[model samples]
Target: MTQREKAKQPIEADVVVVGGGPAGINAAIAAGRLGARTVLIERYGFVGGMSTAALVYPWMTFHTVEGKQVIGGIADELVRRLQAIGASPGHVRDTVGFVNTITPYHPEVYKTLAVDMLHEAGVKLIAHSFVDSVAMEGDRIAAVRLTSKSGRLEVRGKVFVDTSGDADLAYLSGAPTLQGRDEDGRTQPMTMKFRMRGVDLAKVKQYMLDNPDEFYRKTPIDELESLPLSGVMGFFKQWNAAQLPINRDQVLFFTGPEPDEVLVNTTRVQGLDGTDVEDLTEAEHLGRKQAQQVADFMIRELPGFERASLSQVGAQIGIRETRRIVGRYTLEAADVVEGRRFDDVIARSGYPIDIHDPSGKGVAASWVKGDGAYDIPYRCLLPQRVNNLLVGGRCISTSHEALATTRLTPSCMATGQAAGAAAALAAEQGLAPGELDVRLLQEALRAEGALLV
Candidate 1:
């Protein structure tokens, strides 16, 4: 059939979630379980998004530095499911001193389990579909256009939840959005994660002990020896000596469920806009080239990687920052650092402000004050100018500095859970997301085991 001749196939749902990443996955699940007819569209064949596609490993910390679990509900449930199947070792100590705990799992296993959960929740999955445009009725998104195997289709929904980490849905709907840092529109660097197997971790630990000053400053030898599986982020002397082209002052790798495997998150492609196709293409090329360089350096220099082989490279480069919607209320940097509470809080995160340098090497991070948790207000999910739409993930309303903390995997999942529940509630009540009662949303989230104070 001719492209123009083909009819726009229509699918109807109460909540239509775009992007099947960690945020979208939880959003669809929460909405579906809340009795909303949920539809989740993914660009790829699988649903794990960054977790499976980009190989962003060891879901960085669901807890505060004090070991208080700030994220629960669907996020925790996913981990428990993985544990039940022996596909994950669950949360382990962060010997790198970056976070309280890092949850590591097998990427393929994560893909399978995520799909299973979505099906169990009765969320209709549309894989290999890319959202091309949006049909709007005044300020509300009437439907989203999708190009999939069945040909061009239109999905109509009462409420739309954008979990497209890049804010593709909100941006396409003509909503005013913020991109990158405020000063120059430059985003945090993109990383291409790679994995290596056949590593001798014992020798690696011995080297860290012998050269105590070579690793992360906060991590002590005692904590390093406490866990058999720990995230490692040092070997500065070797990294400096090798003079690798890859950016960053130190090398970072994390142990996984596999004894001999380590996920390498070292390659950085700075000064690239993840939203731009050309930039994404260039980033993909540069990131892969840099990944090869890092793997070679590890094998030749690191004590544990003498026999390690580059087993896998990420299907896509890991994007840290992108387009953020200008919602009803923007989360400020101080709110994150001071652990500010909100009267309409829907989600909470203890993960620190971790900014991967936009145009330079290294990262700048600041921890949250008090118990190390801060509120993600419900208003952050309600993008201005859009009546029936809610957003989750890194794209939610936040300043550039605050985005640094909310961009983590666990934080994204938390906001996603909020967005999904809010979408369901709004659809049921026949009201705009802004008109929906924040208290009702909070009650729903709490019943699902979400931690919101």
Candidate 2:
């Protein structure tokens, strides 16, 4: 049921973080800042994972509905850096109220910024390298083998942080993992983001500023004007009237940092496993087809996009859910919907529970109560049977429902920062990550400016 390969040429680190998404970046930075010898491995040449590779712009839910900025630390640093370069427009409300406070940014610049921060933190980065396998010693992982054009190499670490969104390392290391919903193994549909240039934002705004009733985006609330998904329903109605074979009902668009460009998030591919190579390949092909088709549809049906051209397609399809590691504690849907708080919380989450239908039709969400947030406990990051291992991103222990919230970019940054700090402390004290003092870890996090309340 599997394949195998022999590993060679060992390298070592105090902490080894797999995957270079927001989580891995923060983890590496935290460990390095703590004076730990950290190594970060990424499959892509660039650092940003879904944010860059999948073109998933706009960091979401940086604050609670009550408008308290809950996430800080390296995540804040990134936002500030992007702000300094005028590549970010700052956090604002979601037009449709699907989430709160989405900070839209330039993908390429974000990648470069992440790399610069990582390097400045003294974290060694190995790009274009994929984790092949994990070497285990009883309940602990000894090292993980990586493959690249350079050749096969094994990286030994005192502690391992798995930020792979698909939970690749957790699955490989014999940690228990679950996929999708409990009733069935069906995951949320995957989306491929594409961009269009020569967009008339003024025209779109004028249309929205006039025909407010026909558009999906309602009027700006609380004096916060987010990037608009205007003229969505009206254009879909037009698509229907014109007998266009447009399969989607929602119009998801983000205003880019650069004028005249709009990022589109409408390509949805269902019935695919993000972790399976064959399924991923099929999804990619289907995604490409849809990107072209949608670009053509937008030009014909939507205003502002009348003269728009397909400028770029994301390098990879963005799969929202895959394998979720069964960790020491599993975050449940109720915990999020009810805004559960934990004494051991290392990160605060204000995001709602968003589940995109597996059939790729639409999305359903349930928000937290009283405009407050929930806490992600340290237990969720601790994978069962892996004492020295910590899961940092979407793969951290969560039910299919809870992963919907925890998988957001902001949550990933918080979890990643926590995992890296825990790993570094564990390595320094010669203790497993699970056995490290969480109180001390919290103090360290507070000292680093993480907003945990």
Candidate 3:
């Protein structure tokens, strides 16, 4: 800790991406592929932020409402590689006539794949690095200060992508942000996902069919009673009619992973601010205890769990919503519900508006049927009042109601790629992200195999 060291200058790069989640990973990779000296800083040791570390397995929608694969480039390549390794299967047809793509891979697989991709792409990765503050020059982000094992350091970049999910970099850089809803800004409940081993697939399916209401009733849980698994039977019937296999005892239920085995998603703990370290720590403590209670109940009450064993629990609690950067154009619920299209659209999302209540007893979801896809304008990815900064993932600008749908991983990936590509192009050509030609950016994205409409 010499005086010279204390005053050392920050490392500089062409593009710097904070947060190593799906959005950040894709953004960094895209920037690097476009020949930018990209640097990706992550708080955790590994990449794939939520999907791998938090164990949010199974990417939701990769296709448009018409069942055509709309996501490509690194995102699709990763999925294809994982599928080749048997980490995931093909898409599952849902009762609502949508294909739900689930990747039931070990979380470690995602970590490995993500690292391999980043290494091959030549992006410098600094792990165990937590971004603390943003150094700004008026509307432009100058540098980002990070705390790591080595010491506190600063990373300066020409272009910065705020993929921190909570809009940490953007918020600190003086960009306006919206957190949760209302003055208190309450976020959705966080869940701990775990998996169960030796689940009798047959018995689980049967319980859903034969005892729909009773099965949900006897689940021995209160926070999820409002979710009503009994109603899922109708969905199962649709699957059965479509010639999908219906197993009775094999219930991959969402009871929240607990102990050593079950993936629990039932902790309804709320009122904790994800950006606050103390609040997050307390939430983790309560979440772990609640996970244990869920596991115990599943083993004792659920029919297919007579001999089922808990296999693994999530490494991190799955956070649903957080700080959203106020972008140039905030997508709203009306836009999503009406299936609006945009000429400047860079990506589209078809997932439902699934908003988990803070109380954790019920979930609010709006499902769309038949060609109900909404365009994500490029403006939503650009943070307002920032010249060289952009945002993606759950933190992108959108109305509170619209965020319920746009926060999914696939949508995050699409926007991440767009933002990354946009940043690289802007830096390479000495233009601000907002100043870049939309048609040129779109051309570059399409050249990189991104699906844009």
Q: Rate the local accuracy (lDDT) of all candidates.
A: 0.91, 0.85, 0.74
lDDT of 2: 0.85
lDDT per residue for candidate 2 within 160-182, as digits (tens), equals 99999988999999999999887
**What TM-score fits each model?**
0.98, 0.94, 0.86
Better of 1 and 3 by TM-score: 1
Clashes of each: 0, 0, 30
What is candidate 3's CA lDDT for residue 452? 72
lDDT of 1 by residue, 99-166 (tens): 87889888898898998999999999999999999999999999999988877889999999999999
Q: Top model by lDDT, which number?
A: 1
- Model 1 has an lDDT value of 0.91
TM-score attained by model 1: 0.98
Best by TM-score: 1
Number of residue pairs clashing in candidate 1, backbone atoms closer than 3 angstroms, sequence gap of 3 or more or interchain: 0
Q: Comparing candidate 2 with candidate 3, which one achieves the higher lDDT?
A: 2
Per residue, candidate 3 scores C-alpha lDDT tens digits across 319-388 of 8888998899999887887778899988887777777776544566676554668889999999888899
